[model samples]
Target: MFWNGSTQATIQMSTTTPLLWAAFRGAVGDQLPVILALISAGADANAVTRAGDSNALMLAVQSGSEVLVRALVEHGAEVDRAADEVTPLMLAARIGAARIVGSLLELGAAPAVRIGKYTAAEYAWHGGHDQLAELLEVCAGAPSRYDQSS
Candidate 1:
């Protein structure tokens, strides 16, 4: 343990878990080789960070890495899992990651799932991804405003 002068508190330094390191790398860079190695060495793909705010797949979705996202899902990450009230599909749509959203859909992410009052399609529309929003709406089997106009 060490004194954190900035926070005015004592902070215990611990070795970073493979999952946490992979999540951080997923968010900032596409370190696929390293992540795959860690996974092969027994890292749990579904493991969340200490704060319970992130996992490798969530960060991969946020980083817009479709391959990384798919790899994590195939390796046992829950595609529809939510962290801090936000699902991976919700994050993908909010960030306008069409391909990542598609991958998540193929991996069984529920298009109709919602955080509070909004679904993934709503997030896509709010993010200015009209075509993606329409796609998600169709997948969810919900009639979209775009359909009403046609």
Candidate 2:
């Protein structure tokens, strides 16, 4: 029972069980209703995909859907969990999704989370998002790189 890309069929398919597929579909399609329903039905918000080992929250973040990201977080998604070294906050910052970054921070995502040797703020800076870098720095309780007050 492959997801026919329809919300109804996607929800009805028993094959999308274990909640991982449902979460991935809901996030990829930006379907808040489906996401909420799956979560309410005991879907593991942190369930990782076999392909890239990414969870629903990571998918939502990568989709650039702030609403979906927030919804997943509210549903108990692990904010700091990383997929291949990239945390949700890092992904958001790399994409320059300021709203998603803010939401993750508000949900207790640690801005200090490092992917390899770089932190989320560092990733934002590298991505040319000065404001986002600053925001992450502040959230991590670190001084902004833009600050020359040293």
Candidate 3:
């Protein structure tokens, strides 16, 4: 989704399950233990909110918690899946989360994939994360120093 000139994302009504909500809160709050407990209780890591705007993995990336990201992915979160047209890889790259980006790549996230006209490399570049942009470009098979800002 395109930004609406707001620093905050548009909040949407949520009909998400309690387990899902708890997991999401855990991710967002950096409460990994709670998330792990929920996971053990059969929480679906891929379950999204009613608006389909987010999931545990997305929240974890937004929180910049690599451990939470890894745990969620290991519990079956799809790294390349888009929420609000943004992939976890793109989010991580945009935030300059190098470790999380590396983890997502190891989890089989496709560096060449895009949401609309935006690639992860392009997101990184637009966010002023040059190193992440270069890394994503190289992973996508583009030459080093490839300009993704176009």
> What are the candidates' C-alpha RMSDs?
4.5, 5.0, 5.7
Q: Count the backbone clashes (under 3 Å) in each candidate.
A: 0, 0, 0
Give lDDT tens digits, candidate 1, residues 100-147: 999999999999987899999999999999999999999998998767
lDDT of 2 by residue, 30-89 (tens): 488877787888788887765544677877787677888888888888899888889989
Q: Sort by lDDT, best first: what order?
A: 1, 3, 2
Q: Rate the local accuracy (lDDT) of all candidates.
A: 0.80, 0.78, 0.79
**Stretch of 10 with least lDDT, candidate 2:** 8-17
Off by over 4 Å in 1: 1-16, 27-30
Which residue pairs of candidate 1 clash? none
Q: How high a TM-score does candidate 3 get?
A: 0.79
Ten contiguous residues with the weakest lDDT in model 3: 5-14
TM-scores of all predicted structures: 0.82, 0.78, 0.79
Best TM-score goes to which candidate? 1
lDDT value, candidate 3, whole model: 0.79
